[model samples]
Target chain A: AQSVTQPDIHITVSEGASLELRCNYSYGATPYLFWYVQSPGQGLQLLLKYFSGDTLVQGIKGFEAEFKRSQSSFNLRKPSVHWSDAAEYFCAVGSAEGYSTLTFGKGTMLLVSP
Target chain B: EAGVTQFPSHSVIEKGQTVTLRCDPISGHDNLYWYRRVMGKEIKFLLHFVKESKQDESGMPNNRFLAERTGGTYSTLKVQPAELEDSGVYFCASSQGYGETQYFGPGTRLLVL
Candidate 1:
C-alpha cells in the first residue's frame, strides 16, 4: 500500500515570501506523485506531477515540486506566494501498478497574509 | 473541453434515508472514478470504472453503496440506509485512459443528520 504524509497541517506565509509544503511517501517502488490545490467550493486542481521525469517539475500557477527518491519525498514550492494562493493543498501518490488509483495525504492548508 | 461534473452539489439527508449522487465524465473519457473525503481526513478512493465495467471496488465501504455506469456514460452512486459515518464529500473524476492524469469534479457534499 502507498501512503503520503504532509507533516504541516497549516502554514502561514506573507505575500511575496517563498513557500514550501512538505510531503513524504511510503511506496514499494517509484510512484507517481502529484500536487493538487483546492480553493473554496472548488474541485481539486492539479498542480504538478512527477512520473519518471526531471526531479524538479513545473506546474501551473507558478508552482513546482521536487521528487527526491532517496528521501521518498515530493515537496511543493513557490518562489513567492500571493494572497490568492491561500488554499488547501494535497499531495498524492499513484502507480500504474495500482491501476492509477491515488492515495492522498491529509492536506496542508496554506494561509497567505499580506 | 468540459470537465467532469457531479450533480446535487450539496445533500442533507436523514441517517436512515437514501441518497443518490450522479457524475458525468468528460466526453470520450474511458475511465471514471469515485472518491470520498471525510472532514479532516485524506481523500480515499472508493471505486474505479472502465466504461461500464467495474474495474476495482475494493475501497467501497459496504453493500449499501451501489455504483452503476450505464452505457459507459454517466455514473450514479446510490447509498441506501445511510449512516452518520457516510456523511462526507464525494468526488468524481475522469481520465482519458488508464494511467492518465485524471480531472476531478466539484464534488457532492453529503451530510447525514
Candidate 2:
C-alpha cells in the first residue's frame, strides 16, 4: 500500500519568510505525487504534481516541490510566504495501476504571521 | 467554467437519520470521484465514477452508503441510517478523463450527533 507521511502537524511562518513543508512517501514503484492546498470554506486546489521527468515541479502561487526518488520524498517549498497562503497542505500519492485514486497524508496546517 | 459544486454545505442530523449529498462536477468532465475526511483524519477516497457507471467503489465504507450518477450528470451519495462515526466532510471531485488532475468542490460537512 502507498502511504504519505507529513510529519508536521502545524507550521507557523512569518509573512515574507521562506517556507518548507516536508512530505515523505512509501511506495513500491514509481509514484505519482501531488500537493494540494485547502482554504477555509473552500475546496482543495492542486498546487503541483510529479509524474515522470523534472524532479523539481513548479506550481501556482510560486510554489515548487522536488521529488527525490532515493529519499522517497516530495517536499513543498516557497521562497516567501504570504498571509493569504495560510491553509492546510496535503501530500498525496497515487499509482498508475491504482487508476489514479489518491491516498492522502494527514495534512499540515500552515499559519502565516503578519 | 464552473468548478465542482456540492449542495447543502453543512448538515447536522441525529444518528440513524438518512442524509443525501449531491455533487455537480465540472462541465464535460467524464470522471467524478467521492472522498471523505473524518475528524482528525486524512481525506480518503470513497469511490470513482466514469460517466454513469461505477468504475470503482472499493473504498466505500459499507452497504449503507449508496452513490449514483444518473444519466452521467449529477451524482448523489446517500447514507441511510447514518452512524455517529460517519460524521465528516464529504468531498466531490471531477476530471476530464483518466490520468488527469481532479478538480475538487467545496465539501459538504455532515455532523451526525
Candidate 3:
C-alpha cells in the first residue's frame, strides 16, 4: 500500500518569502508523486508531478518539487510566495505498477501574509 | 476543454435520508474516480470506474454507498441512510486513460445532520 505523509498541518509565509512544504511517502517501488493545490471552493489543481528523470520538476504557478529517493520525499517549493498562493496543498503518491489510484496526505493549509 | 463537473455543489440531509451525487467526466475520458475527504482526514479513494466497469471499489466504506456509471458516461453515487460520519466533501475525477493524470471536479459538499 502507498501512503503519503505531510508533516505540517499549516504554514504561514510572508509575501516574497521563500516557502517549502514537506512531504514523505512509503511505497513498494518508484511511485508517481504529485503536488496539488486546492483553493477555496475550487477543485484540486495539479502543481507538478514526478514520474521519473529529473529530480527537480517544475510546475505551474512558479512551483517546483524535488524528489529525494534516499529520504522517500517529494517536497514542494517556491522561490517567493504571493498572497494569492494561500491555499490547501496536498501531496499524493500513486502506484506505478497499477491503475494509478492515488493515496493522498492530509493537506497542509498555507497562509500567505503581506 | 471542459473539465470534470459535479452536480449539487452542496447538500444538507438528515441522518436517515438518502442523497445522490452526480459527476460528469470530461468528454472522451474513459477513467472516472470517486474520492472523499472527511473532516480533518486525508482525501480517501472511494472507487474507480473504467468505462462503466468497476475497476476497483476496495475503498468503498460500506453497502450503504452505491455508485453507477451508466453507458460509461456520467456517474452517480447514492448514499442511503446517511450518517454524520459521511458528512464530507465528495470529489469526482476523470482521466483520458489508465495511469494518466486525473482532472478533478469542484467537489460536492455533503452535510448530514
Q: DockQ of each candidate's interface versus the true one?
A: 0.78, 0.78, 0.81
lDDT of 1 by residue, B1-113 (tens): 88999999999999999999999999999899999999989999999999999999999999999999999999999999999999999999999989889889999999999
- By DockQ, the better pick of 2 and 3 is 3
Between candidates 1 and 2, the one scoring higher on TM-score is 1
Query: What TM-score, to 2 decimals, does candidate 1 have?
Result: 0.98
Tell me the spans in candidate 3 whose CA falls farther than 4 Å from its real position.
Answer: none
DockQ of 2: 0.78
Tens-digit lDDT track of model 1 for A18-113: 999999999997698999999999999999898886899999999999999999999999999999999999999998454548999999999998
Q: Write the per-residue lDDT of candidate 2 for residues A15-46, one digit (tens) a residue.
A: 99999999999999778899999998898999
Model 3 chain B poorest ten-residue lDDT run: B95-104
lDDT of all predictions, in order shown?
A: 0.94, 0.94, 0.95
lDDT of candidate 1 vs native?
0.94
For every candidate, C-alpha RMSD to the true structure in Å: 0.8, 1.0, 0.7
Off by over 4 Å in 1: none
Candidate 3 lDDT, B1-113, residue by residue in tens? 89999999999999999999999999999999999999999999999999999999999999999999999999999999899999999999999989989889999999999
